[model samples]
Target: MAEKYCVENLAVSVLDNLRYQHDWTELQILTHSPVDDLPLPRPLISGLPPRRLYLHPDDQIEMLKSHPNPEGSIPETPVTEWVLPVHLAEKWTLKAFASVFDSMPPENSASPHRVKRVLLATVHDDSTVVYYFMHDGIVKPRQN
Candidate 1:
């Protein structure tokens, strides 16, 4: 019988390649699966500093609203990795986005990964498109 393809295997394979290419001092593979059982074919991985992956918009809004002082405040955002399927090739839809969003926890919530932010880097043939997933709320979109 042919071996069944596992998302975790793909993520691990990619991480191995990344480690070799960057020679990162500390590389940790965060989550092997999504928090919720979404139909999308992909796994999520997150980790600590030296780089940031994603930031949810709603998270930013809540940060702004709750801060006691505007000028002097810094919100701690957690960073996570979103390991999308290698075979996937298409545009994203609302249902897909909704599902991804629903699985992530709010910034205030304590996660085993302890990531307040998430970074989703889509690896294509010779390039990558990274999307940030913030906690939950509204905020000023960063000027591109």
Candidate 2:
């Protein structure tokens, strides 16, 4: 019971940071998995970032082909992302992450090529949150 409360508090802190500090919009706390209707290991956050967090290699190529001049013309569409909040001291394994990935709905139902990924929000004791992208499988590295 107490542990659950702690986890919830951590999630709220991360959400607050994302909204106030990072300027994320349309944030939501998900208690149940949208895909399977099952309770999650911990609450998750979904929100639209201020800018696109990642662009798939294929997407970049397509954009270049369409635009021809890849200067400032490429549209930056912010997509909603799933966030898994955890304390820095917590232990996590591949199976744990796989469970969370399996529970998530597609990033965009209309786009069949999008990959399954999550933003791992790890909160430190000092109330600082760090984010890392976690893909379900190996993804092609984005071109520099």
- Give the number of the best model, judged by lDDT: 2
Clashing pairs in 2: none
- Looking at model 2, residue 136 earns an lDDT score of 88
Please write out the lDDT profile of model 1 over residues 1-144, one tens digit for every residue: 122445566556556554565333344554423344344334554434435334445555666778899777455543434433332344666566556555654433464533333444444544443334443234456522
Which regions of candidate 1 are displaced past 4 Å?
A: 1-10, 13-41, 51-88, 108-117, 127-138, 142-144
Supply candidate 2's per-residue lDDT for 94.
90
Per-residue CA lDDT of candidate 2, range 1-144, in tens? Answer: 224238778889999999999999999899887766889777899998999998778788888879867676688888888888998888788998888776776666685444468899999888889999998888898776
Clashes of each: 19, 0
Maximum-TM-score candidate: 2
Per-residue lDDT of 142 in model 2: 76
